[model samples]
Target: MENKIINFGAGPAKLPEEVLKEVQKNLIDYEGTGLSVMEMSHRSAGYFKINEDAMNDLRELVGVPSNYKILFMQGGGTGMFSAVCLNLMGRTGTADYLVTGSWSAKAAKEATQYGSVNLILPKVQKYTSVPRQSTWSLDPNASYVYYCDNETVDGVEFDFVPETKDVPLVCDMSSNFLSRPIDVSKFGVIFAGAQKNVGTAGITVVIVREDLLGKPMKITPSILDFTITEKNNSIYNTPPTFIVHVMSLVFKWIKRNGGLQGMYNNSLVKSKLIYDIIDKSNGFYACPVDKNVRSRMNVPFRIGCASGHEDLETEFLKLCESKHLIQLKGHRSVGGIRASLYNAMTIAETQILADLMESFFGNKKR
Candidate 1:
């Protein structure tokens, strides 16, 4: 097999090569069941084992509390925006949202349809930094406190979990899920689309506190209702069998590679490699996010000042692509280069990108 390109794209990002190889080996027949995982019935014994193993491994890997139910549902993180409001907003007709970046802002907008949304922080200028918790205008009667733990587009991450007191803290952890250790008990609801760190695009993992269920708004669909999905073991309808199976393999990979702590260590090393380059570039590369609140998973940097450097940025992306370092371009909304150092990204891959950055900058200086 020819070598694979180093992928740094964001979602539908990169799966472990080992997991991909395993899937390739079992694509034709899954454990002598005479059918591919894709061909197997969702209710079949083999398929049931796959689902059970995925959930069990996930629970063990994350040390999820007994009170949390892990539900593997379809629809990406965007779907959960509405599901969160629908399920949690019935308790109090209002929700408090921290608009840290684009995703959180979008979440807040979606919640307004179901109930009142309190923009805890003022309108963000460019999503460069997360506002301090003290500056937030939180409402005591809000149903839940919502925020995106990692803003994939703007590259801002919450370094510390916010204390919501009695209110449930719901996080959209799509880009940074499984990249580090998290206290599961601290948050009432944690949901992530599997495309980032988990597995593929079709599956979304939602861990909801048991007590928070059965409280959806009257118009909530059966699929988006947490209580129905949890009671059905995340199979109220046919789940995303192939994606869940792949995610199960990923869970195994995480265990073999030293679990969550190991993933965290690797992420730090990878992110630091790029950030170090950006910081030392002496204005050649500039990261907009505050250093303390920078995301270890996604690092967005511009080629020059805030005004204009479109040509140089385009050239940098082209040069990186020529070296087989792909997907180095940032989100169009942000207009820069973003290096998404996800779990499957190895230190060697990061080093290659770092070396390219150094070479690119040196050439520009010369």
Candidate 2:
């Protein structure tokens, strides 16, 4: 294995070494242009192609159909929180949202600023699992239904695609984007912050259905309007050039690694091994997410205590850090441990983590 430390960071997470090497190679001079990607003008052909390639690769990777317009915008996923409301609020009285966890709750909160929000907080105690859809209180005439496909903070995920008909379905895929194959056609909008599976921070990706464009609510900013940005090819203003370039490199890496299906297979193996460790640990280590709805990309588990026990968890994290397994801390909202297994995380790294977990937990299924 490589000598570099094993990275388990949640977002701004690990990227493929091959992509890093390519970025390094182009850091100084990009394709004999005598300028780094950072130095190039956003309007220039070189930078334009970089943006186009990033979008095109994402489109192909997710099998985005002709109906969807891919836009690389600034302001991350939070931007979309307002953007979604601004664009769709005019259609109906309120927006419907599933309050699965923190991210979705934040989305619901943001939507309420523009209009009334009908938050569907599924009843499953302590954010431990996703409730069955039969129990979800979906609004029939709602402008749109918003949900976070995976909650990074609480480590809960929707194992099945939500069932929604004509009402547009919006998803905050920030924590779980591109970690597995998805049906792009089912949703009216899907947005992700680039920091997770894409490349770096500072950029957001929006895949909006073509039919859903053209009419933002009166309060919507011009830049936030999907139709306006789509018309301008996401170049309405000087876009995040450096971030887009890095995203393009990452996209190429994903293609090389066999696209979405490959990501699905790789994620399955890596996450399964880690979850297996947690599952077999008995009470020694416990995964908070319900087995039916656990996120394949983000796994949050408790070691040696209930909700209030932070000391032992911190010690375990420090021990893991000493061994070069980094960023296993859970989000502040839900205290425990979190292991983010993104596309760039290798199977071997997870194997090492499983071995460590085994060794640390008395070498027996707890």
Best by TM-score: 1
Regions more than 4 Å wrong, model 1: 1-3, 306-308
Deviation (Å) of 149 in candidate 1: 0.4
**Total residue pair clashes for candidate 1:** 0
lDDT of each: 0.91, 0.86
- What value does the lDDT take at residue 115 in candidate 2? 87
Estimate, for each residue in 1-366, the C-alpha lDDT of model 2 and write its tens digit.
544588898988998899899989989999899999998999999988898888888888889999899998887899989999888878885888888888887788888788898867644547777777888778889988889998988888888878878899999999888888898989999999999899999999999999888778887888888888999999999898988988888888888888888998998898899898878766788886778988889988888844535776877888888888899988877778899999889998899888888888884334
Residue 281, candidate 1: alpha-carbon lDDT? 90
Q: Mind sharing the TM-score for model 1?
A: 0.98
Q: Number of clashes in every candidate structure?
A: 0, 2
Error of model 2, residue 141, in angstroms: 1.1
Record all residue pairs in model 2 with backbone atoms less than 3 Å apart, i.e. clashing. Answer: 281-366, 282-366
